[model samples]
Target: MNFHLKITWYPKKRKSTISRRMVTFSYQVKVNGCNILVCREAFFSVHGLQNNQGRLKNLQKYLREGRSTSPKDRRGKKGNPSRKISQEAVQTVHNFINNIPKYASHYSRSQKPNKVYFDHDMSISSLYQEHYLKYCEQKNAPQVKVSKCRDIFNQDFNIGFKLPRSDTYHVCDEFQIQIKNDQLTNSEDIIRRLKIERDLLHAKASAGQNMITQLSKLAKENPEEYLTISFDLQQTFPTPRLTSEPAFYKRKLWTYNFGIHDCVSKKGHVIVWSEDEAKCGSDEIGSCLIKFLEIQKSQANILHIISDNYRGQGQNWATVALERSLVRTGKFKAIEHWFPQVGHTRPPCGRDFGRIEKHVKNRNPTVYTTHDWVTVIKELCKNNPITVVKMKQADFIDLTPLEKNIAKKDKHDDGSQFRFSEATAFRFDEGMPSHLKVKYQYTEYEEFRTVNITKKGRAHQKNNPFQLSWKYLKPIPICDKKLKDVMSLMPYIPDVLKGYFNSLSESKEQSDENETDVIDIGYIV
Candidate 1:
C-alpha cells in the first residue's frame, strides 16, 4: 500500500507561497524494508536533532566526559574511548574525576574561571579602567572615573610593560601590609644609635684645656714689675625686686652700698654702690686705682690696663683716674689704656665666677639677705685667684742699637770733633803757673781727659738708665690717706655728670657767652 507524507525545509530553505497552509506532500513506499517517518515537523525536528542540539550537546558531553561526571546519570559516565592514552594518563584522569564531587550542579552565570590573556596593544591605563569598572559593577561600589584610574595606574606602574593583570590590586595589598608592619615595629634602636653618634661628635668638637698656661709662663719669667689689673663683673641683671616694685614701694627704696676686695692682695678691689635711692639708675663702678696704688705705689706706673668692654664700666674708669691724677699733678701727658677685642677676652678668673654662681644657685636662698650676700661675696673673692702676669723691662724697649746710633748721629754730635789731643793739653797747662811751682800740676791733656772722658760719657750708654733716673729723682710718695681720699670722690663723679659739664662748656663756647664760673672742689665727699 502507498502512504502520503508531508515534508518541510529548514527556515533558511523555506519558500514563499500565496496560501499560508500550502503543504508539500510526498509518497513513502516500502523501499528496501527501511522505515521512515515522513511528517514535515517530525522530519525537520529529527534532522535538527541530528545536526544541531543533539550533535552539539553530545560533543560537549564527550569533551567534559573525562573532566567530571555525575554518579546519578548513567549516560554521564566518565572516560572516552576515542582518545588513546597510556595507563599513567588514564590514572591521572581517574584521579582528577575521583577528586571532584559526585553530585553535579550548573556553573554560576556570574562566576567564571579567570583566564590569563595578553594583548600587545593594551596599555596599563585601559586595563586599570576595565578592572575598576568591573569591580564597581560587581560590588555595587562607587564608580571611579577612567581618567582617575589611569592617573593612579601611571603613578604606581610608570614603567608598565609585562605587568601582572591585577597589578593595581596587588600593589594596594602590598602597600597596606607595609604600613601596618611599619607601625607595629619598634625603631628605638636606630634612634638611640643616632643620638649616641651625635653626642660623641659634639663632645669631640668642644673638648679643650684651659688657656691659662700662656699667662702662667709670662708671670714666671717676670717678678715685682707693675702689672695692669682689671676684672669683669659677673651676672649683671636688672634688680628683680626693683623691677617689680610699685610706685609707692619705689618711694621707700634705699641704696645698698657694698665693697669688694681681693683678700690675697687688695689690688683687685672695687666698690659697687647703687646710685639713686631706688637703685634704678646706672651702677657706680668704683675706680680701684687709689686702693691699688696704696697697696703698691708702683701700680701707677702701669701703662696699659686691658679689660672687657663692660657697658658703663670699662675704659671710662681708667680715663677718670687719669684725669684726676692729671688735675692733681697739673700734668697733661696722655695715659695709655686698652680694651680687649670685643668678645675675645676670657680669663681663667671668669670661670671661677661661674662656679660661684653655681654655688649660689645650689644654696637656693629665697631672699638675698645682706649677711648672706656678704658671706657669698667673701667666699667667692677668697676662692677665686686673681691671675696676674707681671710686666718685664724687655716689654718696654722698641729701638735697636743701629736705630740708636742713627738717632745719635741725627742729633749732630760728631765724636771725633770733641776729642782732646795729648800735646795740646800739656802745652796749655805749662803756660799756667800755679803758686810759683805746683807740685805735679796736671798737664792740659790730663785735665782734658778727666773732663771729657770721665764726665762727658754718653747718657744712653748707662746701665738701666730709666730705673736709675727714676731712683735718683725719687717721685713724691703718695700717702695712703691721700689715695683713700681719691677713691671716696668717685661716687659723685658719674659719667653723666661729666657729660653734662662737657655739654655746658660746648654750649657756652657756641653762644660766645662769658665762661660760666663755678666753685671747683677737688673732692666729692
Candidate 2:
C-alpha cells in the first residue's frame, strides 16, 4: 500500500551543448500499479520530497478506507463548571423560611415544610431537608415547596422573594413592607405612602378638648341669641351585602342603599336609590326633602338641614333654589334649608356618612337574595336606636372646678338682654318710582297709614305716600349706631323667604315700568 516516487529536473536551453552529458535523476516508485500524477519539480529539496511521499501515503490510506483523512483533533475534553449559590443567597432563603409563620394564612391547617421532586439522582436527605420535609407531612403527599411558594407569592401578589414561599402569607408581609417604606418627604414619595398623616394629626389635636371648646366660638359666645342645630343623615348604606355572593365575586349591577339619619332629631330616613345615570335631578331631590320634612314635622320650624355637597344628594345650590321655589309655590311648608360653609361640615355633621359606612362594615351580612337582604336591613334599621340629645348652652358648658373658681371671682353683667333684631325692610308698589325717597318717622308707638299731602309751597298738587308695617322689628336697647350698622348689612334670613321677597320686588318694578310706558304712548299718540 506504500507509494514512493521521485523525479529530476534539467535546463531546457543547452547553450553549452550538454546533449552528451544529460543531468538525469530517478527514484523507485511504488503505487500498487495505480496511475497517479506527480510533479517532478517538487523533489528538488528534502522537505518537498518528504511532503510528496506523505501526501501519496495519505491518498492510498484514503482509498483503502473510502473516506478522507480528518485534520488533527483540537477539541479539549471538559466544559465550564456551574456557578455556586452565594452565602448571602442561602441566608436570604433561610430568613424567608423562618418568617413563614408571619405570612401564613390564618385558616391554613398545616405548618409543614415544602417538598420538590427532581429527575436527576440527587441526595434524598438533601432534597428532603431543602424542600420536601419542610412542606410535605408524609412521603406520598408533597406540600408546596419553598421554591413553589416563592413563585406563587410573586405571581399571585406581585411580591418578590428569595425562597420558602407561602403566597398567602407573603401578601400581608409585602403590604407591611410597602407601608413601612412609605415615609416619603417629597411629593413623589406621597404616591407610595398609604397612611394619611394629616388625619392622624387632626385626631391628636382634638382628643382632649372640652365640648364647648369643640363647638364654634360664635355659638359658645351668644348661645341665647343664636340656636345651633347639628343636622346629619342616617343609615346612608343600610345593607352591607346586597347579595349572597362575596364582594369580589358579585355582579356589577348589585348595589347597596344607605339609610340617612339625623343626629339632632333622632329621625331615620332612607336614601334607598340614586339614579346613577342622571345626576341630582330636581324631582328626586325634592322628593327626598319632602319625605324627610313629612317624617319629622314637630321640629320642622327650627330645623336647619345640613348636608354634604353631593351633586345628587340634596345639598347643592340647585337644591336650595328648588326648596325656595317649592315653599313659594306652597308645596313645602315650615321647613327651612340651611347649608354649612365649605369646610365647617365635619365631625358628626358632614362626615356622619362615614360613621354609617363604618357601622355597615361592622354589620356584615351575607345576603343570598334581594328580598332576604331587604328584610335583614329593615330589621337592622328598626332595632337600631338613634338617640338625639337636645344640645343647650349648659349642656356644652364644661366649666371645670378651676374655671368655676375663676368665674366666681369675676362680676356677672346682666345690663342687656340678647335679642336678634330685624335689620332691613322691603316694600313693593306697581306705581312707585324706581328711586323713591323713603322717609322713616320714629314714633313712640307703631302705626300704619296712607296720607295725601301738599308740598311746602305748592298747595294745588297732592302727593300720596303709602305706609308699610314692619312686624319683625325689635327695639334697639344698645345704640342707634349699632342698630344702623346692623341694618346696613342685612341680617341672614332664610333663603326661601329672601327669594320670595326678591321675586315680589322684581314683579312690582316690571309692572311700574309698563304703566309708565303706556301713559307715555297715549300722550305721544
Candidate 3:
C-alpha cells in the first residue's frame, strides 16, 4: 500500500535568523487507509505520561531559593485583615465578572505615572458596584457599597492584587537586531575603533564630572574670579494647548528661547523671540552666548562653560569664534569650554527649561500669541529675574570676517582643532592668548584642524524680510492683509483667547501673497 506525508516547520524554513535552535514540526501521514499523527510529545502527554520531569530538579531549586513573584512578600504586609470575604463568594463572582478594581501601592503609582496599578485584592464594594451579587443571586451574597467593599477586600482574604508588569518585548523585524555576523569583514579593526570611541566618551564624561569638582574648589578659593555656566535653546509654541495633529497641519509658528543657566547660582537668563525674528542656528546660539558672557565678564576673571556636543550650535566653529572673541577682550584670565559625553548630559539649563515647562503645563492658559508665552514665562520666573530679551535680526553678527581674521593673522587655525575627539575640554591660556589648545591633552600644534565658518553652505530657508515686533503681549495683531482671514480662524481658537482676536489691528496691509516670490516653497496662488 502507498503512503502520503506532509510536514510544517514552526517559523517557515525560508526566513533568516532562526530565533530558536530547535524548530517545532507537525507532520501527518496516511498509511494504507488510516491517518497517523507523528507528534511524540503530544502523544506522550495525551497518553498520561509526564514530559516536565527532566526539569524537576530546577523546579525544586527554584522553590527553595528563587525569589517569589508575590506582592505580599514585596510590600511587607503584616497579617491577614480582621474581616474576610468567603471563598465561595469569590468563586461565584469569578464565574460572572471579568475584572474587579483592587488597591494599588503608593510606590507603584509613583513609579508608573498615567498607569493604573493595584496591590490589594477586589473589595466587596467593588463586586456590589460591578453587580456581581446580582449575577450570582445567591442567598449568602455580600451586600455592600463601594466604601464597604474596600474594607472587606482589605480585611478579608489572603488574595492580594498586583499590577501586570510588562517585562518582555518583541521586535517585529529581524533586521532590528544587530547580529554583527555578516557585517564583520574584520572584527579586530571594528573592535579597535569601538574601543577608541568608548574611551573618548569615558574621558568626556570624566571631564564633565571634574568640572563640578573644579567649580567647588574655584568657588571656595577664588569666589570673585570664577564662574561656571551652561546654556541651551528651547522652543515653546504660540498656543498653550497643542493640538494632537502634526504641527505642520496646524499652520502655526514657534517661539525660540535661549536659556543661559549658571551652575553655581542656579539662575537662568532666557531670551525669547518669534520664529520670524531668528532661528536656532550657530549664529543665534553664538550671539546668545556672547551676550551672556558680556553680562558676567565684569565680575568673573575665569569662566568655565559646559555644553553638549551638537554640530551646528554648541560645539562647532561658531562656539570657537565666541571663545576667541571673549578671551581677546581680556575680560577673563582663562576661559575653558567642555562638552559632556553625548546623550549623557543633564545640563542645568535643561533643568531651567523643565521648570518653565512645568509652570506652563500646570497653568495651561490660553496662549493665542508669541508674546503670551513670553508673558507667562517672565511672570513665572519673575523672582529669578529671567527677563525676556528680544533679539533682532540686526543683532546677529556675520562671524565669517572674524573667522578669516583669526586665521589670517595667526598662521594657526582659530583653535578649531581643539574640538578633536581625543580632548573632552579645550582652553585658551591667559599667557598664550593667540592660540587655542585642548586642555589636559598633549598633541602636535600643527595637527589642529582649521575653523571654516561657511564650510557647510547656506541654509535653504529664505530670509524673512518683514520684521514684526514680537515684544507685544498679544498675538501679532492679525495683519490687515489677513484680518478677515484671521477672523475666520477665531471660531477655532480656544474660548479664552477669543477676545484678543475680536479687534484686529488696523496696521498697514501686507502685500498680497502672490506679490512675494518664494524660492523653494511652492504656492498655489
Candidate 4:
C-alpha cells in the first residue's frame, strides 16, 4: 500500500508551571487515503522499523531543510577523513623501494617483466626496520609503520626476494597451479611425473638438512674427533658507502666476503678481499679452505665441510682435488665436503651471513674502504667475535688445473664414473689417497661410489703436492671509469681512506668506459 508520512512540531496542550516550555513532534500516518493513529513504538512495530529518535530527528531535519528526500547512505560516501597519509610520506617509501638494489632472475627474467628480486637475505621487515627507518630519518620525513610500508610495497610494486638458482623451484609452483585448476591435458601422466619430481626435490632438501643435524650432533658429542663447518660466499659489499647522494649513483668497488661458521664452537670466520685483489673463483675458495684447514690441522682428525651447490665456488672438481691434496698431507685422517641440495641450501653460513648483514645494517660508521668492511665483520659479534682474514693477492692459489691432472677421464680403472655434478658429497681419506668416495644422496652414508682419482700409470706421491710451492696471482686492475668514479666520490671518503682510493690502479685500456652501471642494491650471489 502506498503510504505518505508527515511530521509536525507542536506545543504541549497543558502549559507546565516550570521555567521552560515543552515541545514535541508528532507523525501523521496515511495509508490509501486513510489515517491511522498509533504511538511511535506501535508504528515502528507495524512497519518493521527501529524506534530511533536520533534517526527520526535526522529525517525530520532533512525534510525540514528540503535537502534530501531520504537519509543518504553516508556509509562509503565519507572517505577516511581522520587518517590520511601524506604524498611526501608515500613518496619516501617509493624512493626507498626503488633505490633498493633489484635484479632480474637469470633464468626467468624474460618470463616476468614486472617482477624484480632483491637479496634472499633481505625481507620486508628488515628493510623497514633497518633501511627504511634510516632512510626516513635521513630524509627528515615522518616514518611510516612497517605494516603501512609493506602495504605500499605490495600495492605499488611487483618485487620479490630471491637469489639466482637459490630460489624455490619455479616448475613445481607451475605444476601445482595446473593441478589445482585441473587443466592438465595429460592429467594422469603429468600429475604422476610432477609428484615424483616434487617429492624427490623435497627429499633431497630434507636429507641435506638431516645430514647437517647429524653432523652438528656428532661434532658436539666428539669435538676432538670430528669437526663440522659450513661456508658460503656473501653478496658483494660495495665499497665507499657514503651518505652523499652522488655516491649512490657512482660506480663503487666490490668487496667479497667468504664466511665459514663452525657448527660446534659457534665461531664465524670471514675471508675478505676486493675485486682488485683477486677474482672469487674456485681457486680463491680453495685458498680460503686451505687457510681454514691450516688452523684446524691439530684440532680434529676428521673434518666435515658443508656448502651450497654452487659449482663455481665449492661444488666443483677443483675444490675436490684440493681436498684430495690436503688428505695427502696426512693432517686430516678423513675430510668430507657435502653440498646441500639446491633451492634449500641454507646452512650455518646463511645464519652467519644474516648476523653480519644485520650488524652492518645497524652500524653507525660510514664504510669507506675494504678495511672498514673487515673491521665491521670483525666487530660483528662481541661474545663470539668473527675472525676476519684479509686476503692478499698472494693468498689466492690456482687450483683449477689440479682437476685435469688428478681425474683425466670420466671412467676410472674400477669402472666407476665420477660425475661431479651429480655427486652430493665428496670424501678424501689419508688411507685411500688415490681414491675418492662420492655419494649421490646425503642419506647414503654407508654406500659410496669410489673412483680412482690418480691418473693412469701415476703412483700416489708421498709428499704433499701443495707444500712444495704455490702459484700466486697478480693484482687485478680496476677499470679506468670505475677509478674515475671513485675519485669523484673522494670528497665523501675520509682523509685516511683517500690514500687507498688514490692508490687504485686504473686499467691500461678502459674497456668499461661506456658500460652502464645499474645501481644494483641487492646483495648478488
Candidate 5:
C-alpha cells in the first residue's frame, strides 16, 4: 500500500494583552484521505504532550519538513554539527591575530595572563576588511565574517581594545584582590594606606585643575602679567601613513608633536619634527619651550604651566633647570609649574591634540612625511590657525650638560627629602634664581620646601647667576631597522612623498638609548 502526506502553513493574526500586533502560524496536515487543521491545545492533547507554544512551534517545524511521509521530531535531539570550522582556518585566525603588533599595558604588565592592547586604529571589522581577507586568500583558508572573527577573539583570546586607566589601577586591583582572598597578613593596614594614596591622588589632581582654571581667569583679566599654558607630547605619528594593507604592516619613521596650548588666547602651538632631526627627550622639550617662550615674551611677564607628572618630559631636572634659566635671564619674573597627580592628568593640551588627531583621521590627503603633518596642523583650526613650528636640526640644544651643573640633592633645607615624582608643584622666582620651591601637595601654596638648586661646588653669583647657553645638538640618525622598514613601505607611498622615504639614512652605530621608547599614551585627545 502507498501512503500520501502533505503539510501547509499560513499566518494567523493574533493580538496580545499588551495591545501589540502579533502574527503566528496555523498549520494543516493531511495523511492518506484524512485532513485536519492542527489546533494548539487539541494537537498537544491528542499527542499526550505538554501544551505550550514551544511544543507547538516544534510541531510546526516538524510538519514543514517537506517529507513524503510523516517526518521524525528533532526538537530534543542533540548532536555535533554536520560541519565545523576547520583546524587550519582556526589556526589561521590565531596566527593572524598573534602577528598583529600588540603591546603590553605599561602599568599592568605583571598581571596574570597579561592583558595586551591593540592600537586605536585596529578593530575587528577593519582587520577583516583590510587585512584578514587578504591573509585568508594567501593561506587558501575560508574567509570568515566580522562577527565570526569577533567571536573567535572574544572566546579564544585574552586581549583588550583599550588599556585600563586609573579607574582600574593595577596596584589597587591587586590589593583589593589580596584582601578579598585573605592573601596578605597585613591586609587591613595595606587597604587603609591604599585608600589614602588614592584619595591624595584625586585631591592633588582636583587642586591642579582648579589652579589652571583660576590661572586662566587671571590670565584673561591681566593678559600682560599672567600667561597660562599646558604642554604635552602627543603620541608619535608614524610616517607613510596610508590606508593600504601593506602600509599597515610596515614600520614608518616617527614624527613627534609637542603641543603647547595657551589657556587665555585659546591658541595652539605644535612643535613638529622627525626622528632624524631630534629625539623626544627632555632637551628637545626644553628647546620647544624656549622657542615658545621667545615667541610669547612680549605678551606676559609671569608664566603658569600645568602638565602631567612624567619624569622623562616635564618634571625632569632639565625642565627645572630651563625654568631656572628663564628666571635668571629675566625673561619671566616668576614661573609656576603644576603637575597633576600621575594617572589623573587631563591637560588642556589634550584638547588641541584631539583636534589634530581628528583632522589627521579625516584628512583626504595622505600624510607621508613630517612636513605633511605640519601642513595639516597649520590649517587645523580655521578660526585660529595652529602655530606649527617645524623644528629644525639647528633649533634643538643639549640641556643635559646644564642640568648636571644644577643640584639634585637628597634633602631640602627642612631636612625632609621628598621624592621627585611625588612633588606636585615647582616655583622658580627671579629673587632666588638658584632656589626651586617645591610643594608635595597641590592644595597648598602658603609655604614650600625650598631646595637650593645651586651646585655645592659652584658659588652663587649675585649678578651673574646660572647662565644658560645654547649647546648645539647634533642630528639624531634613524636606526637601521627603522630605515629598512621605511624602505619597505616606499612602494606603497605616493611618488611625491618618495623622496622623504629615500632620505632616511641609518646611523653608523645604533645605540640602545637612541631606539624609540614605547610611550603608553593615556587620555590624550
Candidate 6:
C-alpha cells in the first residue's frame, strides 16, 4: 500500500567529508493517475537511528495518498517535484520572519542597542558560522543548528538582533517575532494575584458585615463584652520637615511612628520612641497591645483583633503566644485574631496617617526637631483629636520577639504541599488557650505549643524581657559634626532622648529620607 518504489542507503555523501549515514525513502506519487517515483534522504544533521526510521514511515504515508491532485513546480509546471519539511519547524521559520530573524548584520563598534535592545556584536549568518558551531556544545544545541536557533528567536524571547539600516529584508523584519514567553508567564501570576485580591475584598466585605451583626448582638446581649483592635506602621519621619524657601537652612533629625486603632470606636494611638528606648518588633507590638488592653480593662471582656497579614507584626507565633498568655491570665473571655491576604492594608490607622499628614501640611510649620514633630502632631489633635501618646525616650519596651515570621504554607512536616495559602485565623479560648489552634482556613487548623501556667510565657530564640535596664543599651557612636548639628537644631533635649541622640551622633547616621541637605525640606511642605 505504501512505498512501492526502491529504497536506498547512502553510506557517505563525499569521500573527503566525515561519513554521514543517510537513509533515502523511495515511493510512487500519482499525478493524473500516472505513477511517479519520488525519493527523500534523511537530513545529515538528524542522527538518531530510530528518528530516520520514523521519518521514513511518515514519508511512506504521504506517498500512499498524494497531498493534492497535482502540485505545480517552482517554474509553475505540473509534477516537476516538491519538498516538505516539519510543520512545526516551518511555522517557527515563519515566526522568525514575522517576529525575529536568525541572521542580521553584526556591528563592530561602541556599545549601542539594536532594534530590540540587544547589544551583542556578531555578523549575520553567525548562527551557522564554523568556529561558533563546532565550539558551541552538543550537536543538538540550538546555536549549532540553523533551524533550531531560528525557532529560539521565533518562540523564546522578545529580544531582537541588530543590523545596518538599509533596504535589506533583515533590517526591515528585525524584532518582528515577539515570542513574549516571559510576559505570558507573568500574565498567569498577575491573574492569580488578581483572583486573590478579589477574594480578599469579598472576605473583608463579609467580615465587615458579620462584625457589625455580631458586635450589635453582643452589645445588646452582653453589653461591654467585646473589643476589636487594629494596627499598622507608618514610614519614619525625618526632621527639618519644614516649609523653607531656598534661603531657610536648618538641621534635621529622624524617628519612627507605630499606630494602633480601635476598629469599632474609630479611636487611634500613635507610638514613637527614641532609638535607645525601644526597637519596634513583634514583642514590642505585643507589649503595646497589652498596654492598650490594660487601658480597656473595663470596656470589653472579649477581644477580636483584625489586621492585614504583616508576618512579623500580626500573623506570627509571638503575637499568638502573647494573646494566649493574656487569655490564660483571665484578661478576657476569648481572643480571636483575623488576618486578610497581605497588600490589602486599608485600615483606620492608615487613614489616620493621611489625616495626620494633611494636618501637618496644612499647618505648614518647620519640623526642625523631634519635639517640633510632636508639637505639630499634638496640635493636630486639637481639631482632629487622636490620642497622641508621646512616649518618653526611656519608655520603650525592649521585648520584641527574636523569632522569624512563619511561612504561610499548606504542607506538613513530611514535605508535601496542599493547594492553599497559609492560615488566616487564630483563636484563643479562656481554657487551654496556650494550646490553641492556628487555622489556615475555617476547615483547617494546627495546634500551638503549650506553656505551663506556673511559668512566665516566653518566646523562643533571642527574647529580651520587655523591661530591661537602659544601662544594657549598646550605643553606636556618631561624629562630632553630627552631634553639633543636632545640638544646633534643638539646644535643650530631654535626658533620655539626648542619650539616644548621642548614640546616633556616634554613628554619623541618617534616616531613610536619603537626603544630605536639611534645606531640601521642600518636600516636607
Per-candidate TM vs. native? Answer: 0.26, 0.28, 0.49, 0.65, 0.63, 0.47
- Residue pairs with colliding backbones in model 4 are 101-521, 101-522
User: Per-residue alpha-carbon lDDT of model 3 for 159-257, expressed as tens digits?
Assistant: 444532221112201211222335754676765665566456445544555565566466556668778887776655554334433422344445678
What is the lDDT of every predicted structure here? 0.32, 0.34, 0.53, 0.75, 0.72, 0.51
Q: Please give, for residues 1-525, the per-residue lDDT of candidate 5 as tens digits.
A: 222223355444455445332334554445556666766565555555674557556555665564444456665365765456666777889999987855445334334336777766677888889999999889888766688789999999987776454224355455445544555556678767766775665455567666777778999999989889999898888776777787777767778899999998888888988877777778888888888876766557888998877876899998897788778878789999988655444577888887888887787557788898888788787987888899888778777665776888778978888578888789988899788898877565458879887888766443322334444444455556666777877667778867655555423243335555322222222
lDDT of 6 by residue, 1-525 (tens): 222334333344565655433334444444565666554433322233344576556544554454422333345344643443345544443443343333332221113223243324543356346333553343333332576555555575445554333212231232222223455455766656555654454455445434434543554565477776667766667654544343135444445577877666667777664433344566556666655655655457787777756665787666766666567556777887766434322455766787787886787776545566677777776655676665553443433232231223344334444322255666778775534445554222344322222224444332333333332133323234435666564444445555645556544454323334222111111
Give, for candidate 2, the lowest lDDT window spanning 10 residues: 419-428
Candidate 6 all-Cα RMSD: 23.2
How far residue 132's Cα lies from its native spot in candidate 2, in Å, is 28
**Which regions of candidate 1 fall more than 4 Å away from where they truly are?**
1-220, 237-270, 277-283, 295-300, 316-336, 366-372, 381-525
Q: Can you write out model 1's per-residue Cα lDDT over 1-525, one digit (the tens) per residue?
A: 333332222223346555454333332333346556554445445445535545434433443444343234434355775433345533332332233222111111013222222333456455545554564466554444456444444453222233232112233233334433555347666545555654443232222111123323433344233243435544431111122224213221121322222222323342232211112111123223333333444423222233344434443322333322322232222222233322223433355455555665676432222233334445554454332222112212221221232111111122333221111111111122110111111221223321111123355342221221111111112223332342333344445434532433343344343323211112111
Q: On residues 1-525, what C-alpha lDDT tens digit does candidate 2 reach at each position?
A: 656554333445677775754443344444687634444444324235554566545544454454645345434523643343344444444444444433322211123223221223333345446654544443333344456545444453322222233123333345445554536435445634434543332232233112213333434455432222343333322212333323334222122233445544334444443111111233334444444444554322222333433444444333433333333333333223333222221323424344445555777655422333444445444455332221111111111211111111111123222111110111112232111111122121332121111113422211111111221121112122322332222223234334532443353445455553211100000
TM-score of 2: 0.28
Instruction: Look at candidate 2 and tell me the lDDT of residue 57.
Output: 51
| Candidate topping TM-score | 4
- Candidate 5: clashing residue pairs, number: 1
> Residue pairs in steric clash, candidate 1?
425-444, 425-445
How would the candidate models be sorted by lDDT, starting from the highest? Answer: 4, 5, 3, 6, 2, 1
The lDDT, on a scale of 0 to 1, for candidate 4 is: 0.75
